[model samples]
Target chain A: MNRIACIISYDGTNFSGYQVQPNKRTVQLEIEQALKRVHKGQEVSVTASGRTDAGVHAKGQVIHFDSPFRIPAAQWPKALNACLPDDIRVLSARYAEKDFHARYHTTGKEYRYRVLNAEDPDVFRRHHSAHVSYALDIDKMRQAAAYLIGTHDFSAFCAANTSVIDKVRTLYAVDINVHEDELHFILRGNGFLYNMVRIIVGTLLEVGYGKRTAQSVDTALRTCKRDDAGKTAPPQGLYLWSVQYND
Target chain B: MNRIACIISYDGTNFSGYQVQPNKRTVQLEIEQALKRVHKGQEVSVTASGRTDAGVHAKGQVIHFDSPFRIPAAQWPKALNACLPDDIRVLSARYAEKDFHARYHTTGKEYRYRVLNAEDPDVFRRHHSAHVSYALDIDKMRQAAAYLIGTHDFSAFCAANTSVIDKVRTLYAVDINVHEDELHFILRGNGFLYNMVRIIVGTLLEVGYGKRTAQSVDTALRTCKRDDAGKTAPPQGLYLWSVQYND
Candidate 1:
């Protein structure tokens, strides 16, 4: 038996989320169903690096599964894609080193938030970006994001009602890039908490719109309180860009 | 009463085509319906720069109409978007000069064909691009396109059963731009025959794959027969990019 690791991409417009739940369409459930078909109705459990919220897309979401029968590493993508829905696709698949875990072996993660900063709506990109009509001050957003780099207690960025108590995380970098009327926020870090990336984007947007100050963000980090941060941004605009693993 | 010109954009996945038919959903029909709603059931007419085929998209489609009641140019987009479906959007609106017809007064037009030349399909971009698995040589495509950039009797590139027999048209420019695994063909011309762009793409793709040579394209053009050219490409990969008019 071999453990197979796969890089997956999907359009999240129709999925409830990445995690499996009862009575709702989800990425994990669909993938597991496809796996069962390939395994001749045998049950196989799959694990992802992290769970993405509803309407959140992914480019390189990594997963690992143990199969009773061996399929060629190069053919895994085509095999799985044949049984999967049109919105989900397997980008690549290969055999993993022994004792490697998708969640635990990760060294860093990256997330991106896309915003359509335009006076008129783009019909084709509506599902992929958050629409903001007013002009944004990208410089102010960059200033706010600069304070987020380095290790800190990110309690202000995490969502409430999470059972996990530890909020300390190390952020390697945060970047804001503007392309024409599209604004992209890319953040790379050691790890992220529940709703942490969304909260950070929402906070940065507030600064960009002149409603919040960069100094306020620095204070929020020091306090380690959830109430000091901005509201969580919508899930449609966010994407799990990629996950990094140790060499 | 005022004649208004509008720039429109739409996702054509659901529409049959741009023009009206006996009993099918179309972009023109939807726009006319929205116009009727704003005019209190009064009849209104809409004319486009050209009719797009089924499953074809448009980025800068131009249209004009005579309104019974005056609606300010700035408010036209908001007024129409309120009644129109989500897939179609009015990007901009302005007053049109006297005797300015969408189809008649145009000086030039631009069309784009997008192809995802990759090993795997991009799920999010499936509707907007044609996926090709085989390797394509960009240099070959450029060589083939060079022969199509001048005035010629383009009957070989036109679709069969077109009533307009005058097949001569001037192609100003043809550009091939490669972005990683995505290839774009942007062509500008004084005018185009029915399905002319799609046929050109189909023939050029053969050259790209080494199935045909650039010399064959020149021979096909000189023959001025439909059998000389390759089959027409699918409509989903095509887009009416823009229309140019006198300032």
Candidate 2:
């Protein structure tokens, strides 16, 4: 038995997301179906590093599947891509040890959220970005992002429906980069709860728009309440950038 | 009545191009309907620089319309954008002289054809560009493009079914620029016949791939026969970039 690992990229525009859902098209299901076709008639289950929500895109998602058939690792990527849909692509594939796990072996993860900061609507970016018409002070948003780094209780940033009780997570860094008509929020952490990155982005936007102060992020972390944070950002602007694993 | 000139941009993925077809949706017909809605039940006819083929995109298409209503010229661009579909956008609008015409007053026309030169299939660019798996020599393509410049009878470049009798046309320039994995063919001419740019691009590609020689272009032009040229490139990769007028 071989633990086969693969890197995947998907558009996520017409998909329900990275997880399997009943009767709905999903990135996992599509890739699995493609794998099944290559395996002749055997069924395969894949485990991903994380499950991104619907409308959330991915560039370097990592997944692992166990297969009984001994197939050449180098040829698996091309075979998968040949059978998969155009919206999903298998970037790379390799054979791993039986103990290798895609989610459990990950050391860190990176996510990015994009916001279109402009008055006039961007027709080309309507589906891929969140539009913010109001003027935002990027300096203030950058200042607030510094407070969220390091180990802290992120209960305030998590969604209200999150099942996890332990809210402590170590955030390695939070960087806010601003372009001409777009703002990118890059977050690196050991692990993230449900809707945590989107909530943090929303809170930072409040500080940028002058509705909240730079210290508000620290206050929200201390409160340990979900209501203290801003609304969750839309799913379209969120992307699972990459997952890091220590071999 | 002042001639209202407007610059339009469209994705061209859904519509049947700029011209109105019987019982089919078109960019022109949709904009006209939107203009009628804004004019409070008045009909207006629009004339464009050239009729783009189906599935061909445009960024700087010029069109002119005459109306009896006195709408502010500065507001026309925004007003038209608000009513047009998401795939179409009015970039700019202004009032021109009564004698200004989109097709007649045009002095030069620019068109660009993009080909994705790669073996790996790009799912996202499938609809926007042509995927060519053949290896091409950039320098050879550029050398062949130089022979196509200046004035010549372009009968061989036109489609075989075209009905135009006058085949003489002046080509101001023909440039072949290659990027990382993209080959862009930019052509500037006084005017182009049906599928002329696509045919030229196809023939140049044959030259670049060593399937044909550069001398074939001149020979085909002298032959004055459509069969002498290569096959017409796909319409998906072609874009009507801009139309210059001597205003």
Which one wins on TM-score?
1
Model 2, B42-95: lDDT tens digits are: 998889998888888887899999887667787897788878888788888888
User: What TM-score does chain B get in every candidate?
Assistant: 0.97, 0.96
**Which candidate number has the best lDDT?**
1
State the lDDT of candidate 1 residue by residue for A126-169, as single tens digits: 77888888778888888899999999999999998898878889
User: Which portions of model 2 miss their true places by more than 4 Å?
Assistant: A115-119, A131-136, A177-182, A205-211, A225-228, B22-25, B41-43, B133-135, B178-181
Interface RMSD of every candidate?
0.9, 2.4
TM-score of chain A of 2: 0.96
Report, for all candidates in order, the number of backbone clashes: 0, 0
- Inter-residue clash pairs, candidate 1: none
CA-lDDT, candidates in order: 0.91, 0.87
